[model samples]
Target: MTSTHSRARRAGFAAFVGTTIEWYDFYVYATAAALVFGPLFFPSDDPLAETAAAFATFAVAFLVRPLGGIVFGHIGDKLGRRVSLVITLLLMGVATVLVGCLPTYADIGIAAPILLIALRALQGLAVGGEWGGAVLMSVEHAPEKSKTFYGGFTQLGNPAGALLASGVFAIMSRGGETFIIDGGWRIPFIASIVLIGVGLWVRYRVEESPVFASKVEGRKQSMPLAFALRANWLPILLGIGLLPISTGGYYLATTFATAYATGETVALSEQLILDAMTVASFVEFLVTLPIAWLGDRWGRKNIMYIGLVTSVLTFAPFLLVMPGRIEPAVFLLASLVRVAMSATYAPIAAILAQMFRPQARYTSIALAYGVGAAVWAGFSPWFATQLIAWTGSVWSVIAMFTGMAVLAGICTRLAPQHSDEAPVTASFTPRTDTRTNRLP
Candidate 1:
């Protein structure tokens, strides 16, 4: 029992650190796109076009993320979670390190942005692969009574990573105007090398899943993806549906909020908005564990349902009132959005992992999550900005938020659960014979 407890601690810590590195590498690109890439790689006479071009490169990773999911899911499902996770860390680190070495447009003309896009694509692919393996490692290793709490470590990486990326740039910005505008952005991308090294070291220490260990003889699917598509497709769809609230909801709170606060309509200081996000990210990091604990005791789906409903109700008021005020109080109130996000985000690891049989859990969860990220997260921020541009109101974006919450709530209410209490079965269908595996 002590050994099992020790292993669970190691697994949770590994997931947290690995995901922190992966997300830090990914978010550094987002931060750089906003603050540096626009000026460097896509230097244009029109600032709008230049900004658009930089963001397009940022979006490229999301486009290829699903491909990464498919390829890496195959690796994790067939090869083992640890192997896929380590490879993903290496891939993301290498690409991020190369981005630091990349020549600017002035140095290499079109090849600069081309290479930038290629590196970003690699980052997307690596992260797409990384998430599933990390999530599985933690959830599968955890005690059944506390899977959500352990799983929260994976979700905890988001804000922790965002904070690191944002903090790195914030510090780098002080290195004088010439360094910042000319080349300092490379520092964060390059720093990924060190972060990945640390992640690899930590990830190496954790044991492989016993559940995965149990799959042998006739138990293992020869083609996990094929089996996932055939028998577990409903839960996969539900997973995708339930994810918009997380993937998109976060973008709404952070990226879109940044755009709205800094854009012409409100004209808040960029520094104010970024600082607010930094604070909110910290709050989210603090908030996730408690929500996950609650899920473990009460129910993962119930916590998620309440969170989605609260977010649906609060999102409009958040946009219309608090954020519009442009005060520090805005973040204090908006932190509740993070709390709402935690409801779904914290327990999602256990929830999604349990949705399908272990034979295809990695593939199904990874693919569905990749799709959700691409559509909801990758597009939602840009989409929110466009709605404001087209409709001249943030209310339209708020409506979109409400619509997503409704969809997620309905899906969560209906999703068939596969609980940690059940043994990993060869069959892809959820095991309803087990009382704990039944959806409430």
Candidate 2:
């Protein structure tokens, strides 16, 4: 390979590893909150209410992600990508480990739920900052021709983290619910410490993205959030619309499925759900890289639009296939389709990363992405479950996913085809750091 290609590959691999570690910390909670958090931390007389509360708690983390992204994006744009990554990794790892140590409702009463919310919020922030840093690192370092592929490589981290998170949960479940609630869940949370260390070691070794480096050397945005809002309001709105489709789909597919299965006894065994998720993640991992590669030849928007269409078409069948009883065949098919949507968007990091000049890309993309995710994706699982409870069918939830995906496509299409090539006249620089580094 050419030297530039090699550098991009190395950077992509490192970003991939960092993303995996970052997401691993984030997703472990999803598994726990769905399976054990309600019983352990939010114990209540009504099982149904308890589950709803647990889902709400899960959504809380997402609510805080926008602020986290704004803060981290500022740091990445102004300070450096390397520093932003380091702090984000440390924040996520520390918060996750703390969750492992938190006292349950049995021991701490109301404080248990309070602590859970705090930790979840912390996690949201950590992750909110993470995506921008990791994606920028990979996309900036990538060879111009293969940038999307590198972005896809970094995106692989999602499935990698998801697989590991699900695998851990599945293993713990095999030991029995008592074992999981008592101590098993802690294993995954505590594991974050080790991942943090690995992520830091590699992250510190890399240089900042050349694009970001050049921007910093020139003059960084003083207020990235404000600049982004003023200049790219339309992109931000479109991005937000799309966020619910993917974010909603992800949470609903993983957490909601677990809840539905466990409650109805039709959901696959914990082991089975874990296995299905693993398979889906593995498929996602395999497909994401190629999708990103394809974007390079075709266009990032081309691939994403296709994925959006797929999401719209597959929504109903995906849910309909999941019945009260776990049908391994149906489960696999549904999970694979979900994986396809994820895979299609795998290269989107590079697409979004290129949307603005390096001077403002961090803030513009970060704020837009964060707002989209927080408003749409953040509460998706909670909304879906609540809707399901209300309507007694999954049609509404499926429609929501399909609708958002279509909207995202339209919005994404509205963005300039070559954002990196776009001329700019204005920018913003943050006057002060807004990040609250408190970990749960």
Candidate 3:
């Protein structure tokens, strides 16, 4: 027991570190898209058009994430979670570093944006495979009673990565807009190679998930993807339904908000918005584990209910406060929304992990999240920008945010939970299903 607990801790820490690095690479791209990618790669006469174009390239990664999930999910379910993760980290790191090295529009004209889109697609693929394996590494290794808490460790990476990305950009912006626009944005992308090295070292040292080792090792499926689709299709859809606040709403709050706050409408300084985001990420990081711990006692679904509702309530106020240009209010509201969202985000690792049995859990979870992220996170910033562009009001965005929150809440209620160790049952019921068998 003592050795198992120690191993679990090690695995959890490794999951946290690996995901933090991956998400840092991801968030740095998001931060750059909001800040410099527009003028640097996709020059435009209209500032909004430039931002929209940058966000379109940002969306490209997301569109390809589902394919990444399919490819890497196969490796994770067949080869090993550790093997898949190591490859993904290396792929993501190389792409991000190359992004930093690429020439801009001034240097290469149309090819610059094209190259940017290609790298972003690579990032999407890596990340599509990343979340499921990381979550399983932490949650599957966890003691049964503490799965949500250990899973929270994986959740910590999001805010930690966001904090690192936003904090670095915030510091870079202190050198003034010209400094960041001229060259500073590339530093974060290039610096990610160092984090990739550290993540690789940690991931290599950690043991493979015990669930995979004990239950899934010898009895490999002929085709994990086909098996998952045939058996876990409902859960996959439910998983996608449950992730709106975590995926789409999250980007709307952070990436889109950053650009919106600094846009012509709000007219706030870039530094101010970045600083607000930095503080909010820090606050979310502090609260995520505690909230995940609460999910154990309070019921993961109930905790998510609170988060989904709060997201609906707080998001409108967040937008309202931004236009006021009250610095303190902006910081407070942004942090508040993030805190609400954390409840929806943290327990998700365990929730999603438990949705499918260990047979093809990797592929199932990856597909769900990859598709959700592609649809939600990928287009959200651009969608929100277009919403404001068309309606000339933040209310349009608020309606979209509210809709996402509600959808998540409904799906949370509908999604079934399964224990990987539970005995296989012979049934295919949707809501009351508790089967954990490898399908024949």
Index of the highest-lDDT prediction: 3
Clashes of 1: 0
lDDT of each: 0.80, 0.74, 0.90
TM-score, cand. 1: 0.92
Cα RMSD for predicted model 1: 2.4
Model 1: per-residue Cα lDDT over 5-51, one tens digit each: 78888989999999999988888888777666877999888664565
**Best of the candidates, TM-score:** 3
Query: In candidate 3, what residue range of length 10 has the lowest lDDT sum?
Result: 431-440
Candidate 3, 44-93: lDDT as tens digits: 89999999999999899899999989999999999989999999999999
Query: What TM-score fits each model?
Result: 0.92, 0.91, 0.96
**Residue 44 in candidate 3, Cα distance off native in Å:** 1.2
Question: What would the per-residue lDDT of candidate 2 be over residues 324-401, giving only the tens digit for each residue?
Answer: 354666567656676667744685787677655566567667776777777776777778778877888778888777
Clashing pairs in 3: none
By lDDT, the candidates rank as 3, 1, 2
